[model samples]
Target chain A: MIRRRFPWLSYLVVVTGAVLTVVPFLDMVMTSFKGAGEAGTLPYHFLPKAFDLSNYRAAIDQLDLPVLFRNSVVATAVITGSVLFTSSLAGYALAKLRFPGRNLIFRLVLSTMMFPPFLFFIPHFLILVHWPLAGGNDLFGRGGAGLTVSIAALAMPFLVNGFGIFLMRQFMVSIPDEVLEAARIDGAGEFAVWWRIVVPQTRPVLLTLGLLTFVQAWNEYIWALLISTANPDVMTLPVGIQFLQDYVDPTRTMPIVMAGLVLSILPVLILFLLLQKYYIRGVMLSGLK
Target chain B: MVNALTPTTTERAAPSTRSSSPAVDGRARSRRRQAVVAYLFLAPTLLFFAVFLILPLGFALLLSMSRWAGFDLGGIQPVGTDNFAGLFADGSTFLAPILTNTLLFALGTVVLALAGSVVVATCIDNLRFQGLWRTLYFLPIVTTVVAVGNVWKYMYEPGGLVNGVLNALGLGSMAFLQDPDTALPSVVVVQAWASVGSAVLILTAGLKSIPESYYEAAALDGAGPLTVFWKITLPLLRPSLLLVCITQFISGLQSFALITVMTKGGPGDATNVAALEMYRQAFSYGRWGPASAAAFVLFVVVLVVTLAQLWIFRRKEEDA
Candidate 1:
């Protein structure tokens, strides 16, 4: 039926949608180069009257891009590593392992999904203040902000993901038990079986989880804002861009802000381009389950 | 009784064989070993959850019950249920309106995005450049929220492209992000645009799973396209629709960054959803109690809605 009439409608819709989506991005890039006067002018210039790199230059000079980028990278890497390793292991165990309290634990994990994250902010902040760790004081750890102002605080909260575990478990459950038994018969230990046999088998899932964790961690703003506010040195890109907006003069800042936004998002865009297939698959898999 | 007799006879005959063989013992030992390995594999995850998720959730519940400004150690006081009281007490002034707006925004976006995605997906499903369309639509989802927010902020400026286009089309420029009436809806449009790709993908997958035989059968029965879609497509696509609706609901409720960047709940607390409101109260107003209360309220609403949806989905699955 679709093949008969209105075949051109499909092409028109696809082209129109594609143009609508990409035009904003193109506008962003063009606006990043336009002066403030030219930016707010009428009729919306598709191409900049004068191509200027000053906005990019000024943004780099004004904002702590390198430090923020490093912080973002470190935090995202740690959180991704921890989530992938832990979720995969937990997922495998939930899928294949038989234990006394396995079902109970799995159920508990599932139930945690009901708890909204906003509910934890107040308590988590208080706990961070009194956390007994490296920066913790002698009693109740009240002197210094224990986990409050560090990159560790930024990364620590998201290390254990219930969704990640659930996703991995669903994927792992489809794997045959015979493979594990064969590995066991060959005298491979549990860790060996998981590392050599199971881990290799779940590569696609791991990639999906890794890309997701990276994007999420990189884009995290609220927690980063809360924990890293005291330390200007450790701000991530999102928080940095936010603060940059406040510091820059609005009349002259539009271009720089746009430039900073472009800079901030480049990594994510590149990451998406490289791993979009895995990302889409992961979303479908996790969303379906 | 027959099974028991057979098993006993077989066991008696195989006793010598079983006793002589190491494979059975090996199997038992391997099982024990596997159990040990399973625990080993679970250790890191369990430990992380214990310290991070479990402990923090426990602490969050405790904090909700107490009155702490979150900064000072000397002012920690246990004021049980007071925070929750403040949530409802303040509901009349700002919380009620914000909650209504948020829920309304969520519903609007979900419905709009669902409709948009279905149409776009159906159209794209038969297109030649499937990959190109998918990439273009999905681009917004991949873009960082801050970047997208900033771009949209530009687009929403008084003389920007949106207003420019509006004016060009013979309609006067509307106060998209400035006016209270249009701000929330403007944000909704952006959110819908950002989310439609994923919804399309999920619905497309659902559509693909429907056997072509049904369509063939429908066509042979002289059913119109709209009839087939309504009768055949909608019913089989219920699961995906439900998933998209619930996920988009949760996402729309928790939304903050875009609003923060675009409007900052602007023009007199117009776009202040609970999450953004909580941030403002806590960081801007230093009203720890009120913010915590707001957070708890938001949490409850989301939890209840999500659970209700889950229950509905489960019931539907069972019926199927």
Candidate 2:
């Protein structure tokens, strides 16, 4: 009733805020349709003169969209699958199984989340560069470009997520112990019990963790940029588009960059929209993006 | 299946029963096996931590103290405290512009996003299609930083939408990201804009948790909407406000991806922050020692704030 009293004001504020929120995306879409010299011109126009589709063609052709797409998809899939599998398995173990030093391991996992990720960029890159025997390095991890040249570099540092394991463990802790105990008593091994019973029971949290990891890995840029810069052969969608923007002329290529961005963002946008409930819950659980 | 399982299971059982202590021995053996299985399941994750988490940390610390030019571990020259000293030494931009810029950027984002989210979220709680509004707001959050940064960068250009709006209003267009004075704030605005969605979500959740009866009681007392918000909403929303505040502050402190995409920390380092500086030091300049030291300095700032937040929240929990 209190909120109802100023309904007009509320409507005005909410509508205004929503428009402000959506306008950049709308502008990006509109700019992608602008013809050459039409964007970044004397007067900015909200809409294109005509709905041109040529920029998408240029983006695909010039930016090597296929290779970028392949790299992005492979990296995202590997990171997501690895995170989900590892999180679920480790979660089950930490939650249900008896083990020595379990407390210490759990604390270690929690502390891992506390360390800011920026601290790792320098060392992680160096570690990959010195990875022995991969990329022509020696036994001591020296004297070559190392693993940075390979596609696995895109997924390496992201594969094991501490937060994912923590989320899975928290969710699994709620599952009644008797279900696992029953499976175990029925001659089921720990692996089979986790695979059949725990995994299915914890499917919702897994989906949440999976979607979170998928979105993050898909949109990840810095490490991908670093890795792609080290070896151009492993460029992902974001890295490729950014590289093009950095090197090419902005005026002639702005629309194409916009087109590439539109294409690059569509997968995550669609995925988030379809499974937004899970994604939103995951955000809330994590408390920040 | 029975025939296949019979031999191995009997073999496993026979060893425990040989001393006529079947129950105790069997339980102990199974517990040990479970422990082994648990560790086996955890092997990959632990190995990853050993390499990525633990090793990187030790290496980062070591590198912070030693000068090395991008290659060969054997070339590291030990120079104790020099890297840290250089950051704060005379004629160093690290103390004045870089670290100060980082703090100001984080503080500005938290303030702007918090104010905006409070107003928008409180209003949206009473509106229909809340999910749609939330989803719309969350687009930037789901978006790659490259897209958000570039879009905002273009919009801040001379002939772009933001300036276009300014000219339409009979105002001169200003260079947002190019000017030293405006560059940091320009990026801060984008950061706040991109983050407001999640803040709104958290605050709205907080608003929902407040009992509707409080509003009803206020309405009966002839309280104005402003009075109701001030008296009831603000007090009850403190926890969520603090949550958004500290989390956003932490994220703001560490985030350099957007900055990298937008300005790459310059029109002469005008927009440079600690993390970006650290990144450039290593990646661009190949000064591994100084870069690692910058990272540790930034880490100490982040750690202090994080610990303060934890302590504050814990104290609040205890009081509650």
Candidate 3:
């Protein structure tokens, strides 16, 4: 009775909010199936008159889904892999090893989080544009487009995440030093101990960090948008979809855009559903969206 | 720099040669080895920060203060404080509408999301299948901003779902995103909608930490439900509430992705925020100096607002 009150008012409010939250997605799906001239019309219909499969094909063809999908997959994989590798390494050093300037380095990691990402967009773009010896640029980074034309541009700035390092170090701190000492006495090297003991011990946390990094890296828009604008070869899914949305005739292509959006979000949606516990715990720990 | 490596090499060699006391020497050698290994582990991350973080910052600082219109890095001509001055130089739109719109957008999102999440979180706490309900709420968050923005943008059309509902209720259809007055609010609602799920997640955790015995005591005292909520739940939920507000404010201040996707700061800059303006200045018009200046200005605003929020919350906590 204390906790399980059947407050019908609460039910009404929650259900109403839930319906409001969900109806847009339903509208998107329904609108995706609407035939030409059916969408964005007078007296909006909640359901489509016909279940059209042509929109999906049009989206796939017009957006070049395969290339965009490949780019996105590669970018996400590179970012997630690099962040995991760097964060784990830096985190192990910060948490367990006693090196000179350890506290200073840890504080630097924390300070990096406070500087917002928007501050870096302009300069990061410029740096990529002037990155010494890539994409026909000379050693002075002149006469060429530099790294902006490369596929690595999408994943470069985000390869080392300060928050990921912080999260990893916080988790790794509770690992007993005695176990590490035991391994050391047993002739295990530092690299072996970190790889075999520290990593396996922090599997769940690593998963949480990895999933957080994955979703973030996958859905990254502004940087990807900038890079894709510089060179179309590295366009990720969101950038490609937005490009279609902008350049194509919206009246005819709205359904196609919706189709593309649905396709783009499917991977993250499935992952979120499957591993929400880890994702939620990640959010709780980081307090970041 | 070359000389600095001399001591490291000598120190490393000393660990092996100081074998007068074998046991102490062994421990010292291991410690030295561990330090080397730690430095090895930290090398890549430190290198990344040096190139990506520190260099970009110095470059941004230079660009913000200089006038470099084109792609030529060497063509930069330093014009100290002029870019910052131009942002507020009488004819500027930076101070009045863009920054003002940023504040309003952020404030509107925080209010709408906080109210919505607080209600839903408290209600969900009393309900079964909380995980299911939470998963449903979290759908928008996992989805990309392009999807969220476009779906809602389509729904905000004259014949869209919102206007359709209005028309069904015998009201006239409003041009939601087209008009200057309604454009910012329309985008604000979408921003609030997209962010409410995370706020709910945080608030639910906050609610779970509240002791159940407090509720029982309130029940024994014959206090009503609303009273219990006002007195007990609201006060205890302050920290989570502050966190949600600050994070939302910070994100809301700079998040032009949704704005870019939905309205693109349309209807004559009705929905233009500082970040978007900065983006357009750099990318669209090639005004690198003013764009980087705008970026710095917006960063300062974010920093000031966040610190002010912390101060206000801390003071309130002290008073309480």
Q: Top DockQ: which candidate number?
A: 2
Alpha carbon deviation, residue A253, candidate 3 (Å) = 0.6
Cα RMSD over interface residues, candidate 2 = 3.8
lDDT of 2 by residue, A47-101 (tens): 9999989999999999999999999999999999999999999988899887799
Interface RMSD of each: 5.0, 3.8, 4.9
Q: Model 3, chain A: how large is the TM-score?
A: 0.98
Candidate 1, which CAPRI tier? acceptable
Give candidate 2's error at residue B191 in angstroms. 0.4
- Give the poorly placed runs of model 2, Cα more than 4 Å off: B1-12, B15-20
Give Cα distance to truth, residue B20, candidate 3, Å.
Answer: 3.7
- lDDT tens digits, residue span A45-91, model 3: 99999898899998899999999999999999999999999999999
- Which residue pairs does candidate 3 place in steric collision? none
The number of the candidate with the highest TM-score is: 2
True interface contacts reproduced, per candidate: 0.56, 0.75, 0.67
TM-score of model 1 relative to the true fold? 0.91
Q: Give the lDDT of residue B204 in candidate 3.
A: 99
Global Cα RMSD, each model: 4.6, 2.9, 3.9
Each model's total of backbone clashes = 0, 0, 0
Residue-level lDDT for A91 in candidate 3: 98
Flag the better candidate by TM-score, 2 or 3.
Answer: 2
Task: Name the better of 1 and 2 by TM-score.
Answer: 2
